[model samples]
Target: MQQTVPPPLRPYIIHPYLRRTHTMIKKRIEDDILIVTLENGRDNSITAEFYHELKDIIQEANSKPSPKGIIFTGEGRFFSSGFNLSMFLSFKTPREIADFFSKTEEPVLLDLFMCSKPVIAALNGHTVAGGLILAMACDYRLATPNPKAKYGMSEIKIGLPLAIAQGEIVRFGVADDRNYRDLVYFGKMMDVNEARENRMVDEVVEESELIPRAKQLVSLWIDNPGRAFTPIKRLLRGPLADRIQKGIDELDWEDSLKCFFYDDVRKTLEFVQASLNK
Candidate 1:
């Protein structure tokens, strides 16, 4: 789908607060909230570098005394197409895939989900698969009213099983068991309205309102979110995080990797991999 988060009607404030760019993330502080825009090429496919940068940003925001909430948005047509299909295709061995997933991606996702400060996804475009997984970790999500934008966890269709962090975040975020099954097992990508109904996003606003609305919502719980909100959030989600960590600790990557590489899975992945080139 052709879409772009309109050139910020209000250009990002860069003078008073820091404005910085990395390989995959564009960041600035506005109204005391961190505005993080995914800036990798067209689709903002999550790469290892992207995870590192995002994890660093989360650390920096969490370390601050006043606390900084985050608003994650997107550039161009995709909030993110999820993990880069190209990167997965480049994995020559199951060990490489296991290492890439178990070591790098999981830890970063865990950090984001367990962050003390509040986080919101002000989606500027379509979010799917692992990208939506990241969004589900946020405290709240607001998506633009982009007619073509879709949202869902598509990993099942791509022949990957949800890891601990992924499964819990999705389970914790979805409204009910049926929605969970529809998104995870069925791999059905829903339009923005359907996504809201499925609890993938909390609200849908016009494209121009995404950032402003996100900021307003953050402003409400803006003060000492790390102090007040953290405990409450932990109270609600601590067990879930612990469960995910436990699963991660005990997971047999070899077995998981083996399950993901069956003949049908490989063929499907190869087909999707080829589509990326087209």
Candidate 2:
């Protein structure tokens, strides 16, 4: 006699307010994992709405029970191209730009860095600029071995400086300053093997295996009791976390805003907009 097989598990939408839409960041729960997928166009570029929705989702994930870990990934070919340059170009003044970062971007990234549960980045493809920063904030990173996919910080190339909190996160995340300088100062885009070597990614696998591998990693962490894991993680990450918090607290809005109006930056923004128009 044949035995009955159990039905496969299905994911449920976890965010109460999410309306399934092409551009909305999506949240789903499968077993003990919470999956957050970036879905804001081809590049999955960060927008104001994206930041707000993501922050809400992260908060919700932390408040809920049973999910031992979170997995962050992008919808398609690009993990994320970075901050929304188009949105920045729309800002009328440097103060507005400063306010956007202080209120939205910085806080969201910091939240990820300090999340109570372990977070994993499942990089589906190319990740650049602020996208790289976001991934680095996660506890672990796994990427698809797509030769075409590039990874690096391109802020300097784009005429932007890394904010204080962002700089601290990089310093904490990357094991070597030389690699960090190569990514941030030189703006070099590296392939998967190079990224893994430089400690940007923990592992690289086929595209189809990315999510499964991320789940496997999360399961390994989740097997530990939360009471044991949470405190240890906090202790291990505490010093850097404190520095990040201090930097954010002391962030100089006026000095930070000055870069937004720099002639070179303005030209870069114009060039980006022009390219997008084409």
Per-residue lDDT, model 1, residue 71, is 89
Q: What lDDT tens digits, residue by residue, belong to model 1 across residues 1-278? A: 32111111111112211122448888888988889899877788777677767767777766664345888998999998888776666666777777766776776787788776779999888899989998999999999888899898888877888888888888889899888987888888899999999898999898889999998887777564235765677677778877887887789886787755677877887888678657
Which one wins on TM-score?
2
Residue 224, model 1, lDDT:
44
lDDT of 2 at 106: 74
User: What is residue 122's positional error in candidate 1, in angstroms?
Assistant: 0.6
Each candidate's number of clashing pairs is 0, 0
lDDT of 1: 0.78
Q: Estimated TM-score per prediction?
A: 0.87, 0.88
Highest lDDT against the true fold, candidate: 1
Report residue 3 deviation for candidate 1 (angstroms). Answer: 42
- Cα deviation of 70 in candidate 2 (Å)? 1.1
| Residue-wise C-alpha lDDT for candidate 2, range 1-278, written one tens digit per residue | 23222122212222222222435578788777989898877788876667666677667656655577899999989888887787777777766667766766677777777676778999999898888888998999999879999999888877888887687787677869877877788999999889898888998888899888899888877576433555667677767767776776687876877887888888997897567546
